[model samples]
Target: MQIRCNQVVCLFALVTALAFLSAACSGEAGSLAAFLTPEGRQPEPTQTLAPTLEGEPAAPAAGTAQAALQAAVEALQGTPTEETVAAAGGRFPATPTAPLLTEGPSVTVTPGSGRANAWVTVTGSGFPANVRVDVYLAGLVSASALAAAPRSYATTFTDRDGNYSMSFAMPSTWPDGTPIETGTLAVLVATEDFGFRANTSFDFVAETATPTQVPPATLTLTPNPTATPVPTAMPTAPRPTAIPPPAVNPYAEVTPLSGGRNAQVTLRGGGFPGHSVIHVYLGTFDAQVGGGERVRYGSAVTESNGNFTISFTLPATWPDGTPVAPGRLLILVATEDLSRQASAVFDYVVPTPTPALNPYAEVQPPSGSANTQVTIRGGGFPANTRVHLYLAGLVSVSAAEAAPTSYASTTTDSAGNYSLTFVMPRTWPDGEAIESGTLALLVATEDFRVRANATFDFVAPTPTAVSGQSWQGSYYANPDLRGDPVLVRADAEIHFYWGTGSPDPALPNDEFSVRWQRSLWFESGLYRFTVEVDDGVRLFVDGNLLLESWRRGERRVLSLDYPMQAGQHTVQLDYFEHAGDALIILNWHRLSDLAPPPTGTPGAPGLLFSNHPWNNQRGVNQTFCSGFESECNYAGCVRNYRLVWGPYCREGDYPYIRPGLYRVTFYGIGRVRAGATDYGSSRQLFSFGQHEFELPGSFTFCWPGRQSDGYGFETIAQSTGVYAAIDWITVEYLGEQCR
Candidate 1:
């Protein structure tokens, strides 16, 4: 039997073989002739054919590929674990997931006839936009092969219209030779989110077979004088033009990104000209902001495999996160030569919830100002036991305490009630804004990931002149305010901008203070005042000390929000420099200056984060580097930081969601450095927003309410100096939850 094993059955899975074997053994066998039919006849779809008596083929088990793959894997190595999966770049999973889609997507070809590896323009619709799909080619003896066997290759995604069209060269791996008379190209889309999956197929015209050649006739003996053999010219077809290879479209993913600032996001994608530089731009969704408005974060060069990954600190240029940040920002990645481009959206901030943190916690009176008391209550908690409180950002209900983050801490009452007064942290550890977008208040109890959180109002007051006026500068002789400075200067409504230079020329290089005194007016509402300082600094409003810090060679900030009347108030900023260099920056803002608020309120912090030794230790789990293992392990270096994302409360603690105003505070010990100078001894300094405590330090996230059965929490503490760590995160709860 002329069995076309190489072409006629290029992709026969064991399914067809086993079925044929069973029927043959059961006295109802179909002959191998079913598949080895003559050139003209078509075979039935259900008819199965056995391999030749030579040997069985290496056909993969189709209907049970998952189970078969599992058994083979176990026999060879061992069991699969999460660690192995994560290290595999999330591309492959040991276990097969659910089916992609029930109704398969379809593909159509333009001018369908083409030779092997020729460019064919295929259009696809009815698929989700901006998502990836796999494209490939396969061949068989007849069109019936479409239902029997298949394979896939190259990956792509759809456009905003859920449509995609590309002129792609056929994959070189396509089967050839005799039995593979017909072929088809296919597109495959699959994802874990929302169970999205689809496959589209289109047939390609078959190529003409080679003509048989004839040998010269033995006519020498019959050749007579009168019949001299006439020579004839053979006909030759013209050569066809060669086609170029298909260019790969760019594709990438940015990790730990939420369209927010201070985060170091990673963009990873491939399929470009190898080793080429890519010009990337962050612009409005499907819109490009021109000239100055355009912010190019950085550039990346593709590796030899057309894949490149670069890390960058997310810029605060788009102050608001996600929706409000001029809608969604489209990240356009293009080649350096200004040739090809590929783009993706920020649709995914966090990964799909693992069916664990659904039904998030909710709180009343979600947003408010400092010292404002609120309630944190949620279900899924046992009654009558104490539960630990942890603060975090972007509350997604999970089963762990959000630690190794800037969330402050507290404890709930026996009835699962905890009251707290709001106190904004002076030392916000995270580089991202505590109030990115509207704010998502995430609250979680100890040993439980379920968090209850709420938002408070920005409460913008009437318009007021936000500029500082009647400014005065003075220098002190001693680091201690023992006497008045030697030199002084003053400016009416001054706009002073300086570097690490000295404030006064007459004063010495170290232990000098430059205080700016002015009278500022405000509308009848809340206003935020921010000051950036180096070394020791202090601020007083209306003769009341609003913030203070005493440190040397450290950059710190003191930010505060308070209510004020329509009249002018006295503002005094006390600043001092010790040794090295110094810098001071100040600013103010109100809520009305922002764009319209987002529709959905954001997360809030009702958890805690600190280096405080809990359970007779610092963290339930200890990490050497930046605490965030994902980034640290990837970079292959351990930074000077420790982290915790928690279930801090032990079981049976029964942490109650109490009611109160809450705030953030932190303290740590580390060595300080002077600007371009070395300080011989250790110095102490304190800071809030624009000030820092050189020796001891403190910070907090805007606190949040408590909840149950959902929200996940995270925390981190880092230092640039010679090893700095936060001591404790405490949220001052000030309300009644008893009864």
Candidate 2:
């Protein structure tokens, strides 16, 4: 395998101090050694260490080591100094021998990709029968084929047929943060103890794929007695054989898929025709593979035993030099004649997690009642990995349900707990909400390992009935210290914004008064009452005068918060209007939502009344007309004629009060017929009220309840009969002030 030249240069630089250690160990630095290693004795170099792979951080080169050695050698000659001796950051080869087998009885790994702490089956056959086989796993740094001396992981004797199999869990790390991706499966089969040992090796690296079906065919291998001593080369020609089909078929295996670039991986499988030329395909397997998403990795010939193992270096690019990125790579093996095939997968990139995560999970309010929201918080789970949660009754019968399928899944957050929340249903999917009891909730990673659980009792939510009582409205024909009402009816709420419509068709719309009151339920907490009214209005809670705007032609509102106790209380509203549009809106809230929001932006929770339509743009100078309510046609253009209305229009501002329902009532004259003017047509005794927009212009609110444009509502001609009149303007706050 070829390593980038740049890496070679860096590796040597980091190992310059190694020279001092070597020379001092030979007694060459008896006195100058203190200068070479000021802090402590320099350490010796390690043999069989992982070589830096293609994509690793650059290490200093042999040239760097030579230069540092030269500098140290000169310093020890007479001008010795710590600076000259100390240098930081490789293996220099002493000799090279050709690998024993170009084609050998090789190792095949069941799983090509996995986390460091996963077990894989290593199996190979056709070695010296009954011989001792020493197996080990070691990662390759520079290139899988370059150099390696892995530590022994297992020892076993081959069966009389010269076949051996062992399962080994991969170690979780490599030195210097080097990823554990590419490695060699080194097998030493010795004729006797410490005697001549014939070595058979194969390389592998992490690389992905799924099985894509191909035309079916079978492989049959006839072992050749001449293929002896295990590592000797056999015939490379193609030969077909007729044989009985074996009970077990052939399977493909590639090792060490969690690797980076330019490493080697070996492909091994059995039960192929003797001397068959097998083809290999690596990359995305397309249904129409001949055209795209696939490129041939190359081919190999099966030995006489129908078993074949071959090693090849990974390329940094496709056949066309399209750079191979860190992702998935498919491995496919087939007969050159297209008579047989098998496939496997390797996830090319073994990415390091951003945060070194640990496992922790918890369900808040572990013992909450049922039908309420419960949050399951977890921290340090594998980032981006899917997590599944299972709910089950804690009983011996629940064991079968522990199967991986019995759960719901969600992805984990990056670098933190995988937070999951859900409301327990009134009953379990099993239809059991045992009158009162607890159920077990378990959480496991998507792969279904490492489970954590908690138990909490719960109950079903029950419905409550509404109090049938509502507002009772009364009407009077004239604006005065009123007598008995002309009309009376049951009103659910005090939100009367009707214009021109009389409390009764029998009563007149103009010059009228209305009163409404009801009993309501309240919780013990801060409460607020918001009322929008026109003309004159007064409000009383439990007979206490909370707010009043008892003046004719006045348009205003009431808003504020007050403490309240849990119980039923009476609310009453008295309203009267001399003429024009009339409206009233009442609403109540609790706690922080009590105060009129910082700035009035319409549609805010506290918004009692706003004449302007919501067009998104608010608070800012309403210069551009993005098609406001009336002038919507000139959208996207600037219209200095702003359409916003202040709470203090021609009318006064809204009345400030506490959080509670207020009785709101309004009175207005009906619209005049077209072409008619004022309360009565000119030279005529009969006239009708005017529309609110036709009555006067509204302005934006100023500080302390004044129109930002100028004084009160722009004066206009009056109408004798009833019609509409805006009670107030609004820029109800969104929550807080935009400014």
Candidate 3:
């Protein structure tokens, strides 16, 4: 029986194994067999006959069955067979449909075992309608195996569009190890038959704060659907308004207070309205009252018209002990306004006592001769102050003063302006000529302590004359000598002539040869004589020749002792010349003799006497030499010979004097002796005589004249003369007796 049972078991095993193999092959062979058969065989019956095993090939035996089962599992495990997998679905080893979950859509948990609940929705494409999906807790899987099962929650239903969505929650029984922080919750989707899987993960975060009993402050977050809210509170105090002060007056005047008092200021301007204040200051000290230990005292208010007056009193104990002394005072005024303030300054002074009288004085008309007018002007004393003008080097005073004395006195006016004009005394001698001295005026008051003085220079004047005169022309009776008539006798007669010849061309012809004569009674003594003549002149005193200066325009002096017999003793002057102006003057005075008489028989009176009587006659005679004649040869001109020669003889001969008598026996004579060899061939030649004389006391003498070319002795050849001659013989006195 046991053998029979083992044989049954063995047979059942054989049958089951063969049915599995047949079923596996049946899927491949059914389509092939349908193609080979008549195509009328039904495929369902052939597939049913392929595999039949008891209870679907129950668990296999230990060794061999286990081996066979493993082979079958291996064949099913690695990759699905193409026929079976195709028969089951479409492909083998089914590809995953993504965005699937293999784990749960569980509640999130925190560290304190707190639970978090969420709802999930899933979407996919190319997934089956009734596909089974596995959901898992990603926390449940090891970190190393997370890629194998990435989905934490998943669902299987494809709602209307082949997409599946499911609600998930964290399990309450989960170990409190995996924190519910911000991470992905993976959801996997897979198929059961071919072991294909698909998955997706979504982010989740856990709350950082615990639940609180007190209500949170409310905060409203905007624009995000997931933002949380918070809360806060309110505030406290009041608002303030600004207040402006009064406007200042730019043109205000400050009045300084005296006697250590603060200044009072008045304001005048336009833009000040409403409530205002004013402040006063003294120097730099602003906060003092009327006495010591004081406080700020000047603040005040203004009226509506924008005008205010503020007064501040000073402290008795000042910082500088009363600044209003003599010339020193300073005060300052200021206005009190938060926006604008104005300031002004004031000063004051004190008086002093009068002084004593001043002492000073000055002088005028500094320096001049004595008797000069001097003036004195001064000041600085009482009215009617006595001013005494004094001389520095003289003794003159206001009355009968002596030499070197003071001279004048006066008084000052009410205005202290004084002036005095007085003549400097002539009798008051002040030093010498060109010497300097001072004329002082002294000023003094009644007290005599107030005294002053001033001094100036003094000088003298020069001298004068008695009687004098000057003369221009000759000393004779001519008008050129009288010269407009100085002091002279009334009947004085002056005589003048044109001289011997015609008037000189250089002189006026109206009075020539006219014998201009004037006579006067004479008083005689010494005289200054001047004579002007062209050729010669002789002057006589009492018919005695006194002086003869024969040259032209000569002057001399002489003293005559006239007898004073009263009647006129003739004073004659003889003048002779060819052609030129002639004049003579006789002047006399009774002067005492200041010199002695000359010695020896008085020298011959300066006069000339002529022996030729033809001198004064005008007509010409052949026997005489006329004044106009120029002689060439003498005796040949006949009995009384006078010959006139022409321009050539006048060019050669000049005049010489013999002073006294002369004679010419023959006018022209010459000689050539016979039988002399040199004379035998010679012609007759003319010669003239030659002689000279020196008289003793007798004045008469002769001169022998000669021509230019004449022999010693010869006969007269013709009657024509050589030049001119004068020949006469007489006896005359040649000494002082002639006068």
Candidate 4:
């Protein structure tokens, strides 16, 4: 089989050699067909050979047979085959290598441009020397190339380094059948050696041209260019001119001098740095100019700065009088050019020969109370002014007659300011609720005729009920009066509610109630009580009479403490009016011993008392047992009796006591026997003591009655030892004892 292969190879070479010779000689393109023919001729049709064992077909190995067949076919067709070579030689074909594909700087094309050029540099590696590159146009190339044609260029060898660059100009002309548009131009680089090929595209566009036109230029020249000639009209030199100065203003103001005899006039508002003069005018009434009477005073000239002032004295013998009527003084200032003018009229009134007095005064209380110290302050009076304050109505000097109404008075000071203050009387027979009244003040001065008679309103205070008491409990009967009675009845109680009923945990214990009550026959005429009860309450006097109660369903009272007296009283209390009930009561007696005792005999128990000889003795010996006691006796028991001072005492001076279960009694006698002598007397017996006193925190008292003349009674024997401090007292009724 080896020998046969060698013979076949030799035969193939001979045939190929013959075909090439034949083609060269014939010089005909058709003669090259001989190379494509099979190599050996066939035997006669009759000489058939039997199949040999070696010739029988075995299953072809995978890949080996196909690869062998491909190689055989390429060799027969004279196509180039890939091969590995150790070195390069002159026999190697010179093929153009593929260029490195990359982007370049972008070029912008205007809409009307017919062509655009992109300088794409082609670089190659592993390329043969002096290679001829055939550039083929990729059909899907950019519109720039489609509207143009494919272009070609040649490049030289890159020496031993095997690198070269060539630039090609892509034409803007398109192939005959291709349309002009925007597209990509794909390029392929290839060579005969099959060693170089690159597939890539570049972007470009094709655009149409716009229409435009340009105008031609023209020229002109002077007729004679040789000699310079003078023109007929020469520019006239501008004549030098001067500007006039601005106009000046003319106006004046006239003011009266100290005594009105001379007038000072001032000129204002004139244009400076200009020659201008002001003219004075005195004209009569002119109907043609305008209606109205006219009188002129005088005018003056202005300075360069446009200001001038002058003093003009009026004629001593003018029309009206020595001082002149406050009219007919008219002044006018007019410019010399008569372009502007200003006028002023002055009317001066002389001061009166005698001054009048101002009528005004104010009454102020020193301590701001009904029994307040009042001060009368005023002005507009001459020196030695005497002012008298009287009751709103009556005018009298004696305290007895003026006791109902009287005020302090004082002489005016140098500055005419006067002030007088005095103790305000307690009673006002004209009525405490006075609306308006008069205060007479007499003024004596040489030139000023001033009389003092001031009428003013005696503003009364508005009454307000205090806390802790109900509507009918202790309240201000007359709030306007400084000493207005704070009337409170026994068994009467007041209720107060506090705090909002908000459902907040933080304010859980906020709501509370307060109660106020008055005691029956309480020592002090006025009584009050307070409690921290949060509901409605009903107050009862004498344990039965309903003095006061809260009808509202809300908790109105929060906390209060008031005064009380010595009587039967009951308080039905509730807290949070709608929640729980609570109450307090104020009970007191006006004539109780709770009042301050009067200053007198060490052990006496009445407001007023007398001390005389025990035996009615004119001397230590020879004494009458019972007779009119010496009015001048200094030390000796005469007789002591009890009397009622009043219904109640002032509440302000006493301390408040709590109420619980208490035992009370009166201990005093109206008549007394001393040293075998019986004497009848009038005295006051008053006393108070705490029994099981139980009260909540925060309580106080308010009592009624005058503070000055209130007293209480105490036993002389029991109270004599240590300045008469009584813990308890007893009262005994004397039926017809001395009477």
Candidate 5:
């Protein structure tokens, strides 16, 4: 019986296998048949069966391979299980199926063909969730526009389902550079992060094409059946309203706070009106419609979320071409309506400054007499340039340039330093003598901007008095000098200040007298004799009293000019002190050589009235027997013009004469009253002679000539009949007048 069962199984397997083979030959359930075949059993290759002039075998009945495999399995189930089938010589294997394919991001446009400026709707799916998806027109009609940066016309954000929809007009021309005509326009959509991307194309046709004839848009993914096709019109979706931004304040910030010109900076802003045009500028704000000095750097359209980021380069100048200075500046961002604004602060960097050059000069010896060689050293000038030098007083540059004292020019070395020498000049270029003890500046200059100066002190030589010109001094114990001198010595100069001390052990400080005598050889010049003493003092040049103050008085100075020939002359001075400080100073110096007047010219007579010698004041004249013979003028007896001792004659009332040295001459014989009390009280009667008197201001004097008649001389009131012929009295200026 088992044999019989195996036989039945074998018979059914054979028939079932034949059916599987026929199905496999028809390419139906071939994989299942192959799996059901026993292992290690090879199927014989099948031969093509020629048609019996009958139609080719009908195609296998239409059915799923799985369903056909299941029917085949049912047929084999009647035969045996897998193990049983294995025991009965049968095997089957299982294989895995691949996961189902999923579509990536894709985009499409309605109406495959469109005219320029025609609106089109865009649809997309399978992009990142809640991500910005930019839509751009690709395959520009113009080949040249293809190489430029991609420009987006429409933008949208994907929902959680990765779907988006937006509409925009077909660009009439390539937005960047060239024009678009009849050609294909590709639509590309991409996630902002580029994680997913898809593209499709549409036909861009001229306006001549009818909208009804346009074909449907080609898509990168399966087309949506629900999308309606326009027959006679290109229906554009309603333009999306601007997304209202959230109630948040607008704010902006930059990457770097400070930068120089041409520096690249990145800017970020938020909380702006959605889909609004935002402009960026650098300047202050103004209420005027034309705006202030604001310059636009760039513009941007905010996303639906009201946020944006942009990058730009800093400009070097303002809109008005003014250079941007260093300071804190504002970066202004505002909406198109200027209703919203945000600002960021930036610092314009300042450049480092260059150092300045200053030139200076110095001399070796800053002071000397004329013809002194001076070396000037300087630096900080332009290298290898010429430097002009000048010696100038406290004067302006132009004045110094016009009259420079010994200028020199030299070229500086490579180090912008120089050294040179110049002799100090006695006179300037204008022939003006450089006086003694003058201070001047030595100026060095390379150009108007480069100059330096050094001081040069010009001093003239001064004469010195030596011991070879000493005074023989004699000191007495009594002011009257009744006794011999108590001390005798040689004083280099007649200068002493005993104060409260005695001059010598034998002489007392007060009620003492001193005498100084010297024979000096003068140099044919007008000499000034200066005497300063306390109490009483007197000066005599060759026995002629030149200056006298022979009375107790305060220490005072008296000066007079004496004209002396180039020969030895006796100079004597006597001083007496009664009390208090004892002081005496006597000295003489040559003023200048005498320059007498020519024969017939009004010399520099400081004070001269008339030429007639007798028109002077002939005051209170008296006439008597006159023995002295001389020219006499109008007097008591105009016929003889003789004057006696009794109120003889008064000198003319001179006009207001300035203070100066003057010489009075008497041409008549007889003792003449030659003293002037207006000058000083050191008056005395003297014989006819010429004497110099240093008159003080407002001087008045009277001169009476007493003739030495051979009659009994008596007092002035009891006229002794002394007659003197008076001549014209003349006054000559002998020294510089003090105005």
Candidate 6:
């Protein structure tokens, strides 16, 4: 059987060879004899072979398609025999070495030529699959021009086959700011990063002119596997029909001609009493200058030329205070004596009811710490109605619906637009500090019937400083950093010249402030930092203030030279622009590699630290309690006599305190513990006083220069249950005590 199959395969190979030779030699295209046998008989139809014995290897059926194809491949390689055919189990595998295929990106624009604002369809193929691709229209078809081309304002995502289609109106100008005219422009489709791009051309013609015959411009399209097809005939856009305007009345006319109640309208007419007051009224033509007056809208004085124009809101009530029903009302323009009267018909139809929409609100910044002045805006509610805003958790809609007192209330405008600003509460309703990065709900509603919610992200209050080579800059709209930053970004340097321009659109050119901070590493050396400012600037290094000029000073230069250790250090600069020319430039240079002494008579004596009872204070582990019985006034304390007791944690007047012991004095009526601590804990605690008596004490600790920014002296009452009052405390620089 194998021998018979092998013979049949050889015969098939011979026949195929003969057929190819005859066709090539004779130049006959597709011949019917190509599938015929040697005797000119039609070939037999193919059929599946039957199964053979289980133990024995079955031979392929004679004259089968598989046998003949196997015979052809083997013959092309070398030869085929009965033993080889039987060993192969009558079937051979398909060719493994097939050609690899690939494709490149391409784009096309429909109705390739058009004027500005003409809608055009753009189709792209072979783009990055399932990714957003931007389409742009350029004045020039060059790589250099694409960078500045105006976008087509269309974006689309490619399908799995990397094809997308979108449409956008054509722009008027090109990349060079020139008007697109009588020339071919490039249409570009590219990813956001411009990693992949394709370009085609568009002919821009004048609006009233026809597109003349022109040569196709060169396109920047990638090669694809298949050849792109060209359209034989281009499509023409249909001309838009022009509509005739409504005829205007010769004697008098209203600009809009018709509107609902309260709608503003402008009436213009000639031949009215000049230099005279014109009383406007909404009524019928017969009612004007006759039986009585009608609904009198305000009056206006006419010009000297006897031509008058009056703008007023449509009245909704008559002169007798009765409601004016919706109908066609005439606006009568006449003098007080009814001498010159002109009338124009105004159709006061019923206002079309607005379609219902789901109410929604959004908060600017979307996330912030406590006291962040959140601006909430709402829409799609009842107009001229109050909307209550609440801060709720993400428990459920039911939980938010049951909130008691609203955080704030604001009324929507006549167009159903609501907006309000409120300070975010420091804690939740349950008196818990709002956790950082927690999701909170901000609901806006009118009696809960029309309610909408938005998510507010609660971030930590204190900004965590990060280490970088550049400055992390924050810009605020106000001089004081009281609200969310207008702009937060990384700045490579602290040089700016915002003479009449602002750092950000949200901030004003004047009265704006900025804070830039960065942790930088440096080698042990003495560095000189210089700053030239128009207004004021404060520089701090590792919490130690090196320069302080927090005032409105004209352009001035300040420099400070300090020795720094070989490690990481933080630098911060705060500047404000009050008015006029604004500019600030900060720079630092290592003066020398030599390290200076830690302590010495570097400068003249100056007051270092003083604590005020009513100044800005932070509480730790306890809340402050105010009492009328305790006193607050002292020589170095706030003038107010109110008393508050808690952790009297006050930052000293100096952040980077020099190495000095100096003198520490405490005058207060309370038990107090004072020392220099990192946070609120001190190893060398100086305890003094009894709760029932006034304690005046003084003590000094070894002065050790701080290497970082936050180490400072702090004081806390021994117990909050007792009367612990801090009247005055001062730290004076006695001399170089550490060295």
Say which candidate scores most in TM-score. Answer: 6
After TM-score superposition, the amount by which residue 408's alpha carbon in candidate 2 deviates from its true location, in angstroms, is 10
Runs in model 1 with CA error above 4 Å?
A: 1-469, 493-501, 556-558, 592-739
| Residues 1-739, model 2: lDDT tens digits | 3333343233333334554455445544222222323344332211111213334332234433444666534433433344443332223311232121212243445564565556766665545767877643322112222112324455777676566677777554443344444444222333333222222223334343468989778879887668445576886632212111221234466776546566788877775677888866653311111222334566778888678886776776555444445544445576653334444445565345366545766777776554355678776676678887777655432234335334346787766467776655444444445344566777777665656676766554354332348776766767763544556567888777667666666467778888877778877665656667777776677776545456664455455444456788778888886767767777877753222234534323354433332221222222111111111121121233212211221222233211122111112222211111111113321122222323233212112222244222211222224433323233322232222
lDDT of 5 at 71: 36
What lDDT is reached at residue 276 by model 3?
62
| Candidate 3 TM-score versus the reference | 0.19
Rate residue 493 of model 3 by lDDT.
36
**TM-scores for candidates 1 onward, in order:** 0.22, 0.22, 0.19, 0.23, 0.22, 0.33
lDDT of 1 by residue, 323-416 (tens): 2232233355656433444444343232222333332345456665322334455543334434443444454323333353423345544444
Per lDDT, what order, best first?
6, 5, 2, 1, 3, 4
Question: What tens-digit string does per-residue lDDT give for candidate 6 at 1-739?
Answer: 1233344555555554454444445543323222343443333311111223335533332323344445555655555555444443332322322111113455557776788888998875666678999875433212221222234368989876677889988866554454555554545577776556555556677556567979899899987798788878876633222121111111346878667768899988665545878866553311111122233575878777567777888756544454545544545565765434555545666666776866888888798877566788878888888888777656432232344657778888888888877666666665566666645555556557888878788775775666486788877778876554657778998999988788876678899999999988989876767788878787788886656556685776665555678899988999999999899999888877753333423333444445443332111101111111122222222332223222222234323345555455566765444333332234433332123224566655544444355334343323223445566555555656553
Predicted model with the maximum lDDT: 6
Q: Write the per-residue lDDT of candidate 3 for residues 1-739, one digit (tens) a residue.
A: 1232233334333333343344344432121122211322333310111122224322212322233333334343342245442332112232333232212111111221224565444333334555654444432111211122123344465433234545556432223333444433333344443133333333445556776789789999777586566665555422111111112222233444233334343433222343566544332211111223212346656567545566555443344343333222222222442222333323332334334567576666766665355676676766666755554444433343343233556777776566666555444333233334555556555445666777766654443221112221112223222221111222233344444333333223322221222323445333333343444455554544333333333222222222233344445555443244444444545433322323223223222222322221111111111121222222235432323111011111112121222322222232111110011122422122222222111122232222244211111122222322333212222432212
* Model 5 pairs whose backbones collide: 617-652
Query: Which residues of candidate 2, in runs, are more than 4 Å off?
Result: 1-311, 314-361, 370-373, 379-382, 388-410, 413-417, 421-435, 442-452, 459-739
Tell me the lDDT of model 5 at 537: 83
| lDDT, candidates in the order shown | 0.42, 0.47, 0.34, 0.33, 0.53, 0.56
Residue 661, model 2, lDDT:
21
Candidate 4 residue lDDT tens string, 684-704: 222221121111111111112
Candidate 5 regions exceeding 4 Å error are 1-469, 597-702, 706-739
TM accuracy, model 4 = 0.23
Candidate 1 CA-lDDT value? 0.42
Q: Residues 170-196, candidate 5: write the lDDT tens digits.
A: 876665434465654446566654345
